[model samples]
Target: MTPGSGLEQHPLLPWLALQHTRGIGPVRAAKLLEQLGPRWFLSPRLPDCGLSEAQLVQLLTPSWSVLEPLLEWQRQGPARHILSWDHPAYPELLKTLSGAPLLLFVEGDPDALSLPQLAVVGTRHPSYVGKENTRNLVTQLVDVGAAITSGLAIGVDGLGHQAALERGGVTLAVLGSGLEQCYPKRHRRLAGDIVDGGGALISECYPWEAPQAHHFPRRNRIISGLSLGVLVVEAAERSGSLITARFALEQGREVFAIPGAWQNPQAGGCNRLIQQGAKLVCEVNDILEELVAFSTAALKIHPPATEELLPYPDLLDNVGLETTAVDLIASRCQQPVQEVVTRLVELELAGWVESVPGGYVRARRS
Candidate 1:
């Protein structure tokens, strides 16, 4: 179905027009939408709609040239969709951000946006361990029913999408370039796989817009905005993933960073993030533990059916977030240490639990 099918007239034109204005941004556009309802955009009136003189004049005379082609593009693809800020289907988490996109171009399952999401991000050039960590964590995260969100760039972002799809999980790739101009051309096919796998390719730029330097950093906000938390796998001192983490902090979202080898230049950003108080994650469960509390609020809107407990739910509950030894956990669960150790490994891979220096701890709540 079309994104705005039920409406009398497509609202894409006004939403696109509002974004196209030279000086107006998401913050200003949101204000305008709040003051003048859709009728003002449809009727093109110049009333006291809280806009400055220049903005009022611009609103009165929207650039139809920029909007017309976008409308045409939307009509061409059945799965393509446009989400305006006021649309009921807009992501609630994203809508809370002052810099959230006024218009989002989606090219897959739009409902995917409403699902619980965790942003996985890192440097474009990652170490082997970084790639492994991303893939393993993404697979485990999806296994537990959480959707993965990433930028769909090279390295960590690309690995995140591939891992999610490989595990039969849903993933969302937030793009810096438009759908038509997939950045890092090497990953174009990967982009298709994401949509084909029931995931989505999202962009704030027009379909034909090319990847510009500013666009990537600007798009970082959406990555953090869409997710409950941002997880940094690996990053250099100055990397885009750090930018996303900063945005996550500003948006009141949790930030998790994986510690890498101290000497690896790629790890500088992540180490600094931990020093600055972002959660230090060693394995998948670490991320899940942080996500549970954040996701609880979103789940309340339409309470989902309770998730099926993993094997050994009782044993898992015996291990809390606090540190505990294997012997102690075994004693609490009334199981043998050998069996407990084996089960803990399984739980660690599934992201339900973690193993520490002393013993094991609950990484995710049952």
Candidate 2:
């Protein structure tokens, strides 16, 4: 049946009812489905299903008002789809999770959901090094036919998606908000680019649901659930990226972390994860080695080429890993402030040093 058909007899109505029914969460709903099968929704009597009276009433008399927006959104375009648990396009890996969403509002290619994905997640305000690491690793992961998966947040998540697109690879972005209301607002174009590049933007929330603080942590599960493994480039000791790593561990997916300088706060969670047995990722092979078994594609390792000597060696030498003030750098290089500023711009474009708040620091190279 077409999605635009009347709601009263819609095939997906029961699934929607089950999803919105009070007290019938994913876990309990899964149990009910297992015991009664898909036909349970049409059954006249639901004996031994263990649902409360209120839940049964809600399921039997669904609030069609709550589901209208979803139907309208799906009818708007062919690329858009609302996938129920039994839908062929619904991801099997995500289905294995304990609290998997009953419906996924997807925009773009639903087939991308089935691709072998490697999740790359990290801090929203990642350091310069963290940004570089995310881009380089995501690019390499895409080369090996691994689709990148990440939340569409601003920092590392955005970088991962952009890198995958730039490398001409597929990337999936799971959202904390509804598909209609892209979170962070800034990455809305990135979200569209994902679709244009043959990827997808996914959300379990209804089309109108706004982003909430709790939705993000909940969103992390799908990121890990859809992937063969998760690579955490940089995260604080208490970061959302670590939450995705924890979910990866619980889901029996490999967890990989990059070691960072001890002083770097963003690396704390990764270091801790390594101590707790997450594989330490120095190069792409570190992750590829663990996930090769999951993919049919042959592995290809591309070693990084040698670093070329950066111009303005005297000025470059003055820029340390820590944020170095432009004035301080100029003083150390014994050059005028204007000359140093011009040279620093060149250095930045050449991938030598990056301008951060208060100064410049050497860019981390792969």
Candidate 3:
């Protein structure tokens, strides 16, 4: 039913009520559905539905206040939809996870969920090279006719969605906040662009719900659950991108990572993944090679072989894992101070060396 269409007799109002109930989570909702089926709300009493006493009351007393905004949101656009778990169009991949969302509030074409997806995730504060790598990788992935999916935050996530849109490929932005609340506020325009470009803006929260710290980690599961594989471009040792990688592993999806300069804090998690046996992706082919069974077109796309090079090979030899003074590095390399500074800048961009307070440190070379 369209939002604001008919609250009085809408078939889904009761289900919405159950969703809005304070203590009735997906597990409890599932238990109730099992006991009472689709029309579980019609049952006179909740004693046998496995709901706690307070939850039973909350469910019985439907909250029009909480349900009204959702309906209003639906009324705002024809593309918006509230998908119940039983909706035939609900994503099969997500349904396989335990305690999956009972209702998915979607904006844009829901059919995009049926297409093959690859999740690209990384840090919010990516280095310049990390951002460029993400954009290029996303472009190649889209060429193979797969929908890109990400959390839609800044850095790599936003870059992935933007690349897909620029290439006219479908992408999905799964939000940590409500569709109406668009977290970070700056991405509000980006969110609109996604829906306008035939991509999607999705949420499991109410339309007006504000973002919380916990929402993002919960949101990560959905990103991995919806995709055939996940690629971590760059992330810190303790970044949330690693959490998404863990979720992908748990969901039985392939995990891919690009090894970066060892000195890059952002590359720490990705390097660790490579050490732990995640596919070390140097090019899109590394990802496509694993996804051949998932997307036949991937086999047709011939990505160039991976290339690894040092911008200034000699400069790095003078730098070590420990910080070394600029003058000392220049003296050791036998290069002029001005030349050394220029080379250091170039090496940093190549993710080979990082400038420290006193001088520079060499990053791990893969």
Model 3: residues >4 Å from true position, as ranges?
A: 1-9, 31-49, 297-366
Best by TM-score: 2
How many residue pairs clash (N, CA or C atoms closer than 3 angstroms) in each of the candidate models, in the order given?
0, 0, 2
Residue 185 in candidate 1 has what lDDT? 94
Descending-TM-score candidate ranking: 2, 1, 3
Local accuracy of candidate 1 as per-residue lDDT tens digits, 215-308: 9988899999999899999999899899999999999999999998889999999999999999999877777666665565643223345877
| TM-score between candidate 2 and the true structure | 0.78
Prediction 1 TM-score vs. true: 0.76
lDDT of 2 by residue, 22-97 (tens): 8888888878877777688866558557667887788877556766777788899889999988899999899988
Candidate 3 structure quality by residue, lDDT tens digits, 1-366 = 344556666656677778878877776777777677767777765577556788777766756666677778899999999988778778988877766788888999998876789999999999999999999999998988889999989999999999999999999999999888998799889899989988888889887789999899989999998899999999999999999999999888999999999999999999999998899998988898787765675335554456867567787777889999999988999889999999889888878888889999987752
Q: How high is the CA lDDT of each candidate model?
A: 0.84, 0.88, 0.85
Name the runs in model 1 displaced over 4 angstroms. 1-9, 34-46, 296-366
Model 2 spans with C-alpha error above 4 angstroms = 1-5, 43-45, 297-366
